[model samples]
Target: MGRFNFFVAFIFGFGLYFYFDQSCYSYFHKEASSITKSTASGHILAYLITLIPLLITVLFLKKKEINVLEAVGLSGSLTKGFGFAFLCTLPLLVAFSVKFSLNTGLSLNTIIINTISSAFFEEIIYRAFLFGILYRCTRLGFLPSVFLGSLLFGVAHLYQATDFVEILEVFAITFLGSVFFCWIYAEWNFNLWTAIFLHCLMNLYWLIFNVDDSAIGGMYANIFRFLSFFIAIGITIFYKRRNKISLEVTKTTFCIKPKDR
Candidate 1:
C-alpha cells in the first residue's frame, strides 16, 4: 500500500480502537438498563473520529485513484441497482419481525449511521482505495482482487475487540460480506454509492433483527447469509458467462476516459 493509504488505515484503526475503549461499554450498558441519557455528544466524537480518513480519501486519494462513484458499483441500470440493494436485505426482513417484540428505536439511527458513516467510509477505505491500489499494481483477475480486498476489509474489523473468538467472528462475517460487496460493485462498475446503499440495507437488516440476540439469532441469519452468498456467486457466474467481459475489466469498473479536449 502507498504511504498515504497506510496512513489512512492507521487513522481509521486507531480512531475505532479509542472509541470502543472509551465509550462502547457505557453505550451498551445504558441500552440494557434502559437509561435514557442522550449520547449525542459521544456519537458526534465517534463520527468525527471515524470520518477523518474518509474525508482525506474523498478530498485527495479518491480522484488520484478511481472515481468514488465508480468504486462501489454505481454505473449500471437503475432498476438492477435498486434490485441488488433490496435483494441483499430481503434475508434480514424475512428472518425477523419488522416491529420488534420491544422497541429500542436503535434501528433507524443504526441504519442511518451505518449507511452513511460505516458503509461510505468503509467502502472508500476498504474497497475503493485498497482494492484500487492492488489492482493498479498487479492487474490481477477479479477473484484475486476481491479476495484480497475483502480479507483486508474484514481483518480491519478486529478493532471491535481483542478477544480471539470475537475477532474471528467479525472476520468471518465481515469477510464474507466484503466479498459480496465486491461483487455488487463489479455489477455496477464499481459504483461506491450503490454499494454503500446496499451495504447499509444489508447491515440494517442484521442490526434490526439482531437487537435482542445476535448470537442465537445469528444461526437463523446464517442460513440467509449462506443462501445470499451462494446466490451472489450464481449471479456473478451467470453474468461472467453471458456478458463475455473479462473479470479483470469488471474489477476495474471499465471506466472509459475521453480524449483530451
Candidate 2:
C-alpha cells in the first residue's frame, strides 16, 4: 500500500501541475521548442510537481516500515532488478526486426528525449503508481493485477493519440507489453528499477525499428501479434512459478519469535 500511496500522490501532484500550471501543454500551445529554453522551463516545472511524492516514497522506503524493497526493489538490487531487465530484453530484441534507415531512424537527441525524459514520466506514472497502488489492497491475484495495470497504462496513452481507433490499438499494445514488464516487478518481489529499464528499452526498440504506425495492429502489419502474446504469457507463467517457489523457501527462514504483546 505504501507503494500505491506514493504513486497516487505523485499523480495527484502531476495532474494539478499539468492542468493548472500549464507546463508541456502550454509550450505546445505557444509553439515553443520544449527542447530549448522556454520549453525547458515547462519540463522542469512539470517534474517539480512530483517532487514531494518522489521524496515521500524514498523516505518511506528508507524507514524500513514496509516490505517495499522486498515487494519491489531499487536499483541497488543489481542481480534481481538489473538482471531481470537484461533477460526481458530478449523478446524485444526479436520483435524489433524493422531495418533502420540511417536517415529515418532516431537521432541522438531523440534518444535522449525518448529514453530519458519520456520514459521516466511514463514509468513513474503507470508502473509505479498504478501497479504499486492496486497490488497493495487487492489480492484478486496476479494475472488480474497485470491485466488491470496494463489497461490503465494503455488508457493513459490516449491523451497523446489522435483518433479513437489509434488510441484503442495503442492501449492494446501497451497492455500486452506492460504485462511482461509487470511480471518482472511482481516476480522479483517488486523490483522497480527493472520495470523502469525494461520499459525504456521497450520504447527504445520500437523507435529504433522505425515501426510503421499502422503495423501496431492493422491489416498487413509486420507485427507477429499473436506470437508476442504467447511469448509474454510463457515468460510470465515461468516467472510466476519460480516466484512461488522462492516465496515458499523463504517463508521457513524468516520464522517469527513472537514479540512481547
Candidate 3:
C-alpha cells in the first residue's frame, strides 16, 4: 500500500504539472499573438495562472511554516551551496553576457519576476515533486532516478516547439540541464534552493541576453553550452571524491576507540 501510494503520487503530481503548464503556455501564446495590445496583460495573466500548481505543490510540502522559501527548501544554510552553484554557472554566465547581450533593455523588475517565477514553479515541479516521489517509489539508485526525472523534464519542454529539429535540439540540451539540476539538488541533500539558484541564473542569462546565432554562430554557441555541461559533470565527480574521503576519515576515527579514555 505504501509503495502504491508513492506511485499514485508520482503520477498525479506529474500529470497536474503537465496540465497546468501546457494550459498556461497555450493560453498565453494565444493571447499574446491575437491582440497587439494584450501582450503585457497576457503575460501577467499567464504568470498568475501558472501559480495554481505552485500553490498546490506548497500545500503538499506540508511543513508547518509553509512559505515559498521553506517549501522550496531555501531556508537552510546556503553559504556553501550558493557558492558552489554560482561558481558552476559563472563561466556560462560570462560567456552569454559577453556574446549575446540581446535583451539588456529588459527592466530589472521584469527579470526578477520571471526568474523567481520560472525557477520556483519549474524546479519544484520537476525536481522536488516529481523526482522526489519517483525516487521514493522505485527505490532506484541515484543515476537511474536522475535519468528518468531528467528525461521527463526535457520532454516537458516540447510543447511550444514547432520545428522537429528544434524540438530535438531543445530536448537534448534540456536533458543535460535536468541532469545537472538533479545532481545539484542531491549534492545539497534535496534542497531545492540550490537547484533553483542555478536554474534562475541559467534562465536569467538566456532571458536577459538571448543568444543571437548570427553574432555567435550555432556551432560556437553550442560549444559554450557544452562547456557548462562538462563543468556540471566535474562538480558531481568532485562531490563524490570529497564524500569518499570524509567517510574514510570518519571510519578511521571510529576505529581509534578514543585512545583508551
Candidate 4:
C-alpha cells in the first residue's frame, strides 16, 4: 500500500511538472489573450505558477530525503563540480554559437530568465525527480535509469512537431541529449547541479543559435552531433576512470553500476 502510494505520487509528480505545466501555461495564455507570444515576464510567470504544484507534490512524498537543491546537482563543491561542469560543456556551446550566429536582437533578459527557469524546471523533473525516483526507489541500475529518463524526455518533445520525420529527428536528438545530461549527472555522482549547468548552457546555445532555423546542412549536422556525442562518451569514461568507479552494466537490469573508489 505504501509502495503503491509512492508510485502514484511519482506518476502524479511527473505529470504535474512535465506534462501539465506547458499545457496549462498555453491554455491560460491563450484564454487571457494578453501575451501574444512568450515574453520574459510571461515565461517566468508560467514557470513559477507551474512550480507551485510540483513543490507541493514533493512535500507530500514519503521520501523527503531527496534534497532538491542537491538533486538539481548543486550540492557539490563549487570549484570541483560547478566549475568543471561549466568548462566541460563550454566547448560544445561555443561551437554551436559560432555555427548558428548569435541573435543579438534577442533580449538578454529573456535569455537569462529562460535559461535559469528551464534548467531548474527541466532538470528537476527529468533528472532530479524521474531519474532520481528510479535510481533510489527501484532496483534499476544507472544506465537503465538514464535510458528511461532520456526516453521520456525525448517523448515530451514530440508535441513540437507534426510531421513524422521531424518528430523522429526531434526524438533522436533529444534522446541523445538526455543521455548526455544523464551522463553528466552520473559523472558528478548524480548531483543535479552539474547537469543543470550543462543543460543551461545547451539551452542558451540553442536560443542564441535560433533553433527554429536549420543553419547547417545534413552532413554538417551529423558531424556536429556525432562529435558532441563522442565528447560526452569520452568525459563519462574519463570520470569513471579517474574516480575508480566501474561502469559495469548489470545483465539482468541493464543498469549502470558505478563501483565506488
TM-scores for every candidate against the unseen true structure: 0.61, 0.62, 0.67, 0.74
Estimate, for each residue in 144-242, the C-alpha lDDT of model 4 and write its tens digit: 677767888899778866688878887887787787777667656666776777677656666676545331225544565456556656876787889
* lDDT of prediction 1: 0.57
- Give the higher-TM-score candidate: 3 or 4: 4
Worst 10 residues of 4 by lDDT: 213-222
lDDT values, one for every candidate? 0.57, 0.53, 0.63, 0.65
Best by lDDT: 4
Pairs that collide, model 3: none
lDDT of 1 at 172: 81
Ranking by TM-score: 4, 3, 2, 1
Alpha-carbon RMSD of each model: 7.4, 6.9, 7.8, 4.5
| Predicted candidate 2 versus true structure: per-residue lDDT over 37-57, tens digit per residue | 454444545554544454345
Worst 10 residues of 2 by lDDT: 248-257
- Candidate 4, residue 68: how far the Cα is off, in Å: 4.1
Q: What are the clash counts of all predictions, listed in order?
A: 8, 6, 0, 8
TM-score result, candidate 2: 0.62
lDDT value, residue 38 of candidate 3: 52
The ten-residue window of minimal lDDT in model 3 covers: 246-255
